[model samples]
Target: MKLLIRNLSRATTEAELQAMFESFGAVQSCNLVKDKTTNKSKGFGFVQMVKNGEAKAAMKTLNGKDVDGFKIRVKRAEDKPTEQPLQDAE
Candidate 1:
């Protein structure tokens, strides 16, 4: 299960986030969004849990939880559809 985490502090690191979730269950992957130019945290990230039950439990316990003065929001990441280009007929 993929979990979307938002409202994170700029100082938050991927390792810190992973450790926090590891207490609940195993984390398959952890990522923190960053700006291309600034290379700084975008205040959000995604975490992948191997098990659905464990992911759900982590979300339940972590949502609205404060970390470094920020109350983060945790939820299942929505699957984004692939973009397709329009075709023109002659």
Candidate 2:
């Protein structure tokens, strides 16, 4: 299951997130969005867990919990809309 984590501390690292989520279960992936120019964290990230049950448990227990001085929000990630390829004008 894919989970979205929000309002993370600016100083939080991907390793920290992985470690935190790992307490509940195996984390398949932990990604922290970073700025293209400055390469700084966007204060949010996504975590992919091996199982839905573990993801739910992590979300239920971690939501609104303080981590690295921030009250983090965790939930199932919304499905992104698929983009249609643009047709070139003749």
What are the per-model numbers of colliding residue pairs? Answer: 0, 0
lDDT of 1 at 10: 98
Best by TM-score: 1
At residue 77, candidate 1 shows an lDDT of 99
Tens-place lDDT digits, model 1, residues 45-90: 9999999999999999999999999999999999999898988988
The whole-model lDDT of each prediction reads: 0.97, 0.97
Question: What TM-score goes with each of the models?
Answer: 0.93, 0.91
Worst 10 residues of 1 by lDDT: 81-90
Following a full C-alpha superposition, what root-mean-square deviation does model 1 have from the true structure?
A: 1.4
Off by over 4 Å in 1: 87-90
Name the TM-score of candidate 2.
0.91
- For model 2, residues 1-90, the per-residue Cα lDDT tens digits are 999999999799999999999999999999999999999999999999999999999999999999978999999999999999999999
